[model samples]
Target chain A: MNDPKSSLTQVRDRIDSIDRQIQELISERANWAREVARVKGEGLSAIDYYRPEREAHVLRMVVDRNHGPLSDTEMVRLFREIMSSCLAQEDPLKVGYLGPEGTFSEQAVRKHFGHAAYGLPLGSIEEVFQEVAAGHADFGVVPVENSGQGMIQITLDLFLTSEARICGEVELRVHQCLLSQRESLEGIKRVYGHAQSLQQCKTWLRVNLPSAECIAVSSNAEGARLARHTDDAAAIAGAAAGKVYGLKTVADAIEDRADNTTRFLVIGRSLFPPSGNDRTSLLITVNDKPGALYDVLSPFAKRNVSMNRIESRPAHTGKWQYAFFIDVSGHIDDESLQAALKDMGPVAEQVRVLGSYPVALP
Target chain B: MNDPKSSLTQVRDRIDSIDRQIQELISERANWAREVARVKGEGLSAIDYYRPEREAHVLRMVVDRNHGPLSDTEMVRLFREIMSSCLAQEDPLKVGYLGPEGTFSEQAVRKHFGHAAYGLPLGSIEEVFQEVAAGHADFGVVPVENSGQGMIQITLDLFLTSEARICGEVELRVHQCLLSQRESLEGIKRVYGHAQSLQQCKTWLRVNLPSAECIAVSSNAEGARLARHTDDAAAIAGAAAGKVYGLKTVADAIEDRADNTTRFLVIGRSLFPPSGNDRTSLLITVNDKPGALYDVLSPFAKRNVSMNRIESRPAHTGKWQYAFFIDVSGHIDDESLQAALKDMGPVAEQVRVLGSYPVALP
Candidate 1:
């Protein structure tokens, strides 16, 4: 056996060498994460695309190959952070959501980006898309529908008029909150929230806050924030806003419906190859006649493509007619989908593709 | 034809008769809505006892009997309003949610209650649930999970430790936004939002407002309202708050991930017989062993019951001991489910039922 001093020296030298290699490897992995972020970023800029699955797949592979104390899930989670940081380094994507701060839009951004994206609060749905279109940000997140309230008409109109393609989708679980500066609901003057939120809380507001005026805000988050700043003013928003603004919750769970939710769409510059479970959105104007509407929809009916949404809006061009916005299952690239579009050409005046994206679940 | 005056008189009498019937009918319907709301109110106070399907079915029947300009869907919608109003009147169920205002929690309340709920905002998750248990409110709403951000540990903890029961659920589409008091982010010095939101917007915050301090608030709504009140402060919230507070959006869609969403849970009194598609939650403690977990879960496997969630929390009373909170797809009253619980007795030190309720969806 070697002497104790000699053995210690040998071990120290080996340890030093290993530490250097580990540091180098970490730096290399970080660089790779940065590179991946750069590529993804370029695509996002020219076209709105964020491939979460692909990135996740890569992280999984890296974690599996690692022979360390960290578990694969933990390792992947850590790597996700590294990758997110890299993406941020590449290009910061600005998102516009209906706002004050604690609104569902902010929650949407958090759900979409995890903890690595910047959430921008916007005043309206149009402004959200406009920010993305004008290059002020990489993507726009807007609410398209609600389970109880139905669709957000303004968002549908944006889809009808904008050239932006639908890049992604997300489902958010919404919870309405009652906020007041006072500890109790006594002597409350006004209840503030979005029109939809106010409508949802109508029954409760009427019963409990019978004398209180129900004021509409642009977003639930905004209402919460505003309530924090005003005296005797109550706002309906998420609990997050109350904590953020240091406001007390006078009550909770005030919605008339129990299973409420909102579906949001991600819009960007370009579209991607359809994932099998794709939903396509389009806008069409048919001749203002009885069966003209039926004719435009016949193609979809014939092809057996399921129509998920069908809404009509006035053609804003001063024409004595309305335009229909349709959303159907299956990608535009599908044979039947193409055939359906072809068949609808003669039944209308104008047709535009709103884009195809994956279905979302919450 | 008869004399014009005499004919007019006859017609006027007929019209008056019709009008009297209409008024009586409206009053009757309104009263019925209140009664329905009362029945539903009992369900809210005891949410697990609330069968959404039953409520929906009843409301559907009411709509089917309606006669007038309103279509079947419209009639049902009106009935929904009545039911919601009635429910609010019953107990005026108060709820606590993470807030300032206008956050997804408010939206979730709207989704759950239809268009009639009394939403309350609180400073934190604990605060929200605390309101429910303390009788300050009838129920509470809080975010439990996110598509991008994963589980909300705080809510999980509340469920694990609190006396409140899981009554309902709401999934909302999250839409994030960027708002500033000014028109642009050019001179923004600070970005405000909840901690989770700040983390979600990390990439964008680092890039655009690189030098800006990202302050964590309770909710995004409050953050936006704060921004509205202060100069050089931008808030990440939703549009609702902006409309209420009159804040401008500077940038939008700044999340690192494009598909973001948050899932919220409704908490209230003990559950009763579930509606269709039920879920049961329970907490169990097991002896230390290699296959103890497997043994505890074996009952579920044997019964062919699908388990949705299984999480472990450190036992509050001991060190190195943990309690498992499990959610499964079966009612406790089911033979198989009861048998599973009986079988679990040997392996578990203690077992507590959280609740058994219908699977509410968006």
Candidate 2:
């Protein structure tokens, strides 16, 4: 028993030594990132100093090299935060997102850019695009889709008119919580939440707080704000909203669906170079005729290029006319995609390559 | 000029005469609807009394028969409301939706089922499904997609597990407004809105109320509720929300995107027979192999089924595995789709027919 205890102490000592080395290496990496930023700043603008594609490449490499008990996702996340902190040493990236703060959009910005980036919570998706286009923000993150809901039309419409390009994507798993000042659900008379949040948590609330009046608020954070002041009111919101409003979780993971995910796009002034594994978004208007859609898709199909998503929207120029937004694997620079684009020209009335950027890290 | 004025009066008299005939015909139609319900009640349950497929067929016919200054869309809407009222005279449908009222979901319910259907505002999408499946509500209306955002995962996820069928669909053009008790934007220290509404109206708010604090609440109606009580606060919401809360519109049509729209699904106990113009939604899981996605898509393409949308979601049964939700133009009962499904059997690991229903009227 004494020998075992002594060996455990030795193991602890070794771990302590390793942690110190790791900490020092992280500091060293930050210094190197600062140096790289300085060098880039000397030759380029502040916006150009941070290369999202390069960062994506580095993170991909981290995943490739990782073979551990910890997941590749965890490893990539750790490296991203380190890189973000390091990059902040020179100048923090200014990121705009749709927010009054404590919304899922804010969460997506943090997941993509990390905590080191300064988040500018704008009022709308258009503002996010405008800020990025005007260079008021280094980049903007706005939600393009939810796994449950089909699409956000405003974002797609903005892309049609704005010069902003897709630079990266972040998929956030939306989790709702029951928050309140009260310790239990028993005393809760009213529940406040964003309409969506309330919808997300409805089943749970029905099963638990059967009689509570579910009040729809502007945001989950706003619900939390209201819940904080009331003794009998609870709020349905994200855990972050709970934290923001200083509310405690009366119940956790109250959302009806376990895998409710929102997909957000990082919009920048220009498309970045491919990060080995990338996706290209295109806006296509097909000639109004039978098999027009089939003709538009055949080029990619014949080339064996995989399509990720395709959505049709009213072209707005004419009644019954539509514009299709397509997401396909590979960058525009790739040979197969280039060939596909060339072939698409004859069938499509207009084909605009929105941008090529790295796929969101899983 | 005297003759023209006299002729105008004569035209007005003719218009009044026509209006009287139209009103009597509408009443006659309502009586016939009630009579049809009585006949249906003899052999059918209350749930079967409302046939969405039949209603869709009638609406399509209305569009086909129209040759007037009123657009097909306008004509269809008017007929829909009439049908809704007629249906209500027999038995009002208890339609469940994500609501505390004044949410877009509520609007969709009204647009599809009309004011005649008793809107059973539920807490969540799951509850909506549960209500429909359990026969507590005659049908449930839930948002399946947005044009701006991609999919609502929870709704799709519910479809995977619930036995509810898609009987109809509603597409609503979302419009936001600034409502306040105050006369104008001046003296508004705070603006309250649902996060999405705030985001939708962000550009207008920023340009109009630069110094006002934008506060996110649960729903736009909730925001209106707050705004109604305060002189210095304004709410960004839909016109319905403003009406519900007794607030005047400070600014109208303030959404950044003119074409902001949401797609909602009408869920019921079982699939209704096909309308002439219909859409089929399928859930397919493919084998884990290269070109698997292509194999799944090829079947649809070869038959020229014309897929409307395709979305991939985590299968949840395993990590990195995906299940696809596909919308194709045509009913499953159609020969082409039937043949396509047969061919898909070999390519897909599992295939579930979610539902086949009428395409939403333009």
Candidate 3:
């Protein structure tokens, strides 16, 4: 609401008034969610406070209708946090992720669930899965892939044994930085970093601090922690991690690759209906023979279904048998997908549906 | 070679004789590789020393023909090194990988190229690609995926632009250990590790050193270095890295997930023919329309080609066009695969064949 005739003071007052209305609207929306939670909690043994399908639907709408000075992604990220704050009012969502502290997995959790969700750092990916499966946490955030690296195999292997399913997906661009509390990059005797970050910023360290002894630590945050106390040491981490340890950045965005990104999945115990645009993951093993894999995939091919991902792992059996993990387009609730899956059953030794989830907007 | 009763002096002589024979055989193999190189290099202006298809075939043969107390994988690993040594006689394979020395990428490079191939640690994945593409290196070894994590998007995205192709693949089982110069874990004040390792050993650290501050460093090797010098610091890293910095393992195999692994790709300047059992990776951008993915995939489905992996990325454009990176079951040289690609051309906006290489043995 802008007025050309308004003085500077009047404009400032109008801005403040608009801000108050926005806060009121947000509060009202949160109140509605709280009431909905109350109504849904009754007559049900358990009310799934975090409905991924519903959240996906809302985010899609927000992104689709946005026409702004702020980019669509930026708008969606803002709304996501607002929705996260609102969702917390009903019940603060508990999220488990892989970490000691300040890990990408933790960042993924914060990014997707927003500031309102309680973030719990687990020891490992399996622990994150167990935390959700055992009911200690409402949801789990685990990295499934990094754009620079390939898939995280342990996450996929865990799905073979865990009942937790994919409820949503999120991706964050990974930008590594060289951080320090030191006065300069020069005169640094040692550089601390995580293994990945060390690798990511390998050249910069070599060229900039040729004689500094490079060391790898647990996380970028941990690297920054050591950098804070060690006089001549600098840590390679992210800008966020640098702040967590109160370390100043000697150099930021030092990763060798600029477009590096990581994709994470949100896991929960239950599955829900489709959000129209969705992706489904499955774990299957085919009969160990010539053309065995072909048979297993034929059904989806015949049905005009698009298979998104198929990864193979050795079955760990002494023999050469293998297990296949697959991701395909469409939700299981869709009729055509159901028919395609039925055909997969006979050809595969075992076919377990991991989960059907909304495709990530970004 | 095994002299059951040879522990005594007389038997020791017999063992020595067997060792001589083994050395002679290896030398002979190297001589053969040298001779092969000489003949191949003649009359050919452009020569490829590292034949990924040929190496894959040999490794396959080594496993297939094995009859031993050592498992197939173990036997194959031994042969891989031996082959690497033999190939080096022609010209030591120069491989560049992401590293600050003693990184898992270095390990992967060593594992694939063997002791003879020169391993160069480049600072970035982009550098690794550039090294190979610019003819500065024979091949570049970089991680494409990890078991606990998913695909390395940087690698895939790089593939979108680089002319280098994937020729081989290798996987290393990631085992994080707690290393320190200290006598025991009790007095530990700070545990240093790579971000991945710290999380991998989170549970173990929490149980043993509840109050210890966990720090992240550049690489596990870097962590080992920090732990070696810092009296109260312990590093969670691989045994190889611990040995590099002479840090003793306070605790071994501390990763929460037992089956943690990282997958790496061998990239070179040109493509190679199939090695019987092969996997092909491709970069495909689909038309911006509903069912565009389905249409591109339908060709493979119709031909009964077993598709291995397909992932989606937003095609950096104004209207959110998407790119599909895929792995399928055969080399591009295969008739059926060629037919599938021919069919794919019409449905997709752009298609680029990444490479075809043997599936990892382990």
Candidate 4:
């Protein structure tokens, strides 16, 4: 018989060699990123060196070229992190998001900007915009909408006044977990989570921890923090929060919805150039007329620009007057969108192009 | 000036007399509601007596006829509550909602069904549907979408299998507050809230309670429960939650967004007739083709049936295939929508009319 031990050893050696090669390629990529930084000059700020459009383009290519046992999303995520790590070698990008650490916003920052980027957790979405506009942070990631909810009005309202521009978007599938120090559900005396989290997991909690005193806390991280300290207490939070607070997951994916996604926008000081596939957001005020909305919409529809979302808010300029926040496919630079804008100028009271950036990866 | 005290007393007496007259009218309305129950027969279930479409029509009329100091929205709300109270005199509508009590879902139930309706706080959205379907409850209130988020996938998915139909909608303006026993931010060493609530009030907390340890809990009411017990702890929750737990609001309306609204759907056993101004939700599956989405959308666009929202989800039947959830203006019974559906029949694999109900009161 053939030597089975020798064959197994040979396979193990091949695996080790592949890992080493992969590590070497990553190192080379980091060197290339540094070289690019050097070519850009040392005087330039980290924000200038970080090109969201360029990164988006590269990520798109990675997805397009991918065909493997690994899913496209997983492959893209890996590349993004690798790119983030390499970018950090030159100068870490400072990204701001609403947080006290371990919030979903923090997770979104990590997801988009990568682990190597410096995440500055701000107190509010307004502060996130302020920080980005003031150049305190390279970019700010604020939630724009939730799949289960409609829109984040505060973020939309900020865009009406703030000079911040949308550079990218991150869609995070929010998963809630039951974190506890106890090994089983029976030992839990109280359950802690954010109010929303509690509602999200109401069914699971009721089925499992029916009689437990469910408490509301500031954040999932906070719940995890409390759970860490108390043996009988359990928390409902994201797995990331549990990891941060060193708690064990008694149960996972406890959210009521299977696809609980929150869409976040990366806000920057200036609009980035298009990355082939992109989305344009506009803030428009229409003239008070019956067909004003139809007029605004017809331009896009005629031009074959697919409208992604439309939201109406109090114009704040006049009582009962409304401003429409519109998201449409195609970058502002696209000829079709340009033609649509040209057509819209006469019908709309005012049209403000918020930003044009790459769409979130599917 | 000569007899100011006498005038004040006379005004007080006049106010009391008006209050008595109002009470008599309210009593008379309640009696009529009982008569409605009696005419409908005692054998009918509570759900049978509760007509969401009828209530919607009445509320719309209330808004249209109002020409007073009170806003149209305020007027509609008062009439709704009064109607709800009257409906309860016949037989309290058993409304199920995703809850442990003091949650937003429960709030939605009360907002739509009113205080007199027996609010059955269920564990999950599925339970809500199940209860309503099994005839255990008159109607079930469950969150379908948030103005900030997209759609609740689980709810949509349930529509595919559940027999429950959308009866009405309730739009609740979500407001968060700081509740405490110590009465001030200085004494608060720990803050409790849901993860989302914590993030919502992140800026406020950072500015006000920078040093306070924010903890995550299951529900805001739970946090209030905790806050009620601890002198040094505070909770970020709805004002209702505070009332439920006997905690005083240290600060109110501290949410990051001013117009944060949650849209909940009232689901029942069968579809009700249209309320004139109505919305129809549809679940559609399109065949595998390049222009499948375009084909699905063209019918609505061509028919001038305004499409409100469209959401795509995994079909679950095939890998990478999708199913769409669409919300459109007008009822399924309306000619425009009916024609649109007829046109869509040839293009779509399947079309399911989930429900047609009144547009939510503004």
Q: What TM-score number comes out for model 2? A: 0.45
Instruction: For model 3, report the TM-score of its A chain.
Output: 0.80
Candidate 4 lDDT at A220 equals: 62
CA lDDT of each prediction against the hidden true structure: 0.66, 0.75, 0.71, 0.75
Model 2 / residue B360 / CA error / Å: 62
DockQ scores of the candidates: 0.03, 0.01, 0.01, 0.01
Residue A167, candidate 1: alpha-carbon lDDT: 71
Off by over 4 Å in 1: A1-49, A52-83, A175-196, A203-254, B1-362
lDDT of 3 by residue, A235-289 (tens): 8866655543456777777776676778899899888789889999888876589
Residue B15 local lDDT, model 2: 33
Query: What is the per-residue lDDT of model 4 for residues A36-91, given as tens digits with 9 covering 90 to 100?
Result: 55555555445657878777877776666654333455456555666666666544
- TM-score, first chain, each model: 0.66, 0.80, 0.80, 0.81
lDDT of 3: 0.71
lDDT per residue as tens, model 2, A240-338? 556434578999887777777888899897877787899999999875689999999999999989999999987876655679999999999999999
State fnat for each of the candidate structures.
0.07, 0.00, 0.00, 0.00
The TM-score that candidate 1 achieves is: 0.41
**Model 1: per-residue lDDT, tens digit, A1-362?**
15544553453344333333322333344344444434344454312335543443344354446443333333333344334433453344556677655566876765565434556676678877876777655678888888778888888877666788787777876678898899999888998998988988788888999999888876675677678668989998767556544579888878877666888888877766665567888888766777888899999989988999998888875566668889999888989999999998888888888887766533
**Model 3 Cα lDDT, one tens digit per residue, B1-362:** 13322323343243233333333344445444554555455532113456677667766765665543334554555556556655544445667788554456876886677655666656699988987887756788888777556788998778767798888889888787888888788788998877877877778788889999988986565576567678888988766555434578888787776777888999987789788999988888875888898899999999889987778887664365788888999888999999999998878888888888888876
Candidate 2 ranges beyond 4 A from true positions: A1-16, A34-46, A64-74, A177-191, A201-212, A218-258, A318-320, B1-362
